[model samples]
Target: MKDQQDIVDNPPPGGSTGDPFTISNSLNAAQTVTVWIAKGTRWSDRDQVKAIKVVYADGTARVHGNQTGTSHSFKFDSDERVTSMGIWTGDRVDRIKWETNQNRTFDHGGWGGTEHSEELGNGILLGFSGSADSHELISLGASFREDSD
Candidate 1:
């Protein structure tokens, strides 16, 4: 759905009442970032599919798909990356996968019918159904885990 007005005004459980779903972070390097959304039973009943949009450090924006439960990736090339991410949905996302370059990866396999939060690595923190503005913080809905090398 192209209309963001309705989603902004009456957001779902974890969404902001008037503000859009926004998460931002500052990164140390230019990296390939990937985000994934998994389809759930709630997706089938709605006419609008949930979407994830990403705003790079350079102010350019990229928009990614309906509730198809797939992975989407983009590149950020700024010294101090200011990456903003948002998810728009009428229900819960089954799973979310986030990876940065090859340095780190955060995976939230699925949601088990509630909100939760988890911390990954020294800088990555995630919150279920919420907002975050740094690598040390994140707010959204998903089961959490971290991987690094």
Candidate 2:
């Protein structure tokens, strides 16, 4: 487990634009995560991430960015917890991948851009913070807390 002092907010990746948003789950764990991926009108353009929604164990939910693409949802098992995440970004978020403690993996979006991976070694995902526009997600970052056990 990581030290409590080591848990801190990660800065958003990519060329972030638009208003900043923060969605936190400090007291509970996440139950589900949904991501939206959008493709450009032109055939040569690559796909980009549009939005993300997370539902917590308490039944409360929060979402950011725009709903302008295909949506993919991943539900966690009772004992499953997200252990790490990877994001690819350019001018916008291009791809996202999440891995659970159970070794389950969930992925979304297209492959094009710089990749940023977060390995949360026993740390709890506390929430997300980032910037987004009406058309797509501009940037994303994860927040974590030290595992108490």
Candidate 3:
């Protein structure tokens, strides 16, 4: 399932209708520094997983994980620079953090600093990344969170 993201203080992105799910919407609509869940379909119905493809109007997506459950949070950010962020949770390992490609490319973990994440429920994780460049602010990694319900 997909819909326009307009919640809380977070408004629509690009001011271009904000209807980003349309195939006609330019892929460029997804270049920003925010994170919003794209909405998932019911599992038994054979729902195709919909992932966040563009940047957000608020801050970005953050994921949290633990034995208790996995959790995800999306909000607005004013001053955070990141290049890549991700959350990895599994039976053996569970971890999350954000980093700057420039920092990692140069062996500087401090470059992008660490992205903060928290677990919401099960193995479902949430996350997001930012960059100095406004257009390239969000860089996230995850094949896609597994259904933790």
Best by lDDT: 2
Where does candidate 3 have its weakest 10-residue lDDT segment? Answer: 6-15
* Deviating ranges (above 4 Å) for candidate 3: 1-55, 58-70, 83-86, 89-93, 99-149
Q: After superposition, how far is residue 124 of candidate 1 from its true place, in Å?
A: 13
Error of 1 at 25 (Å): 11
**Cand. 2 Cα-lDDT:** 0.77
Question: Which is better, 1 or 2, measured by lDDT?
Answer: 2
Cα lDDT tens digits, model 1, 1-149, are 32222121212244233223433323322134445444343444322223445554455443333424455554543322222223333334333444444444444434333332223332222222333221111224321123331
Q: How would you encode candidate 3's per-residue C-alpha lDDT over 1-149 as one tens digit per residue?
A: 32222111111111121112211121112222222222112222211112232333343322221112222333223332335444332111123344432343111111122333432222222222211111111222322122232
Could you tell which candidate, 1 or 3, scores higher by lDDT? 1
- Residue 55 Cα positional deviation in candidate 2, in Å, after optimal superposition: 0.6
- Against the true structure, candidate 3 has what lDDT? 0.24
Candidate 2 local lDDT, 35-69, one digit each (tens): 88888432238888888888988888999988777
Candidates 1 and 2: which is better by TM-score? 2
Candidate 2 clashing pairs, residues 3+ apart or interchain: none
110 Cα displacement, candidate 1 (Å): 17
Each candidate structure's TM-score, on Cα atoms with residue i matched to residue i, is 0.27, 0.85, 0.21
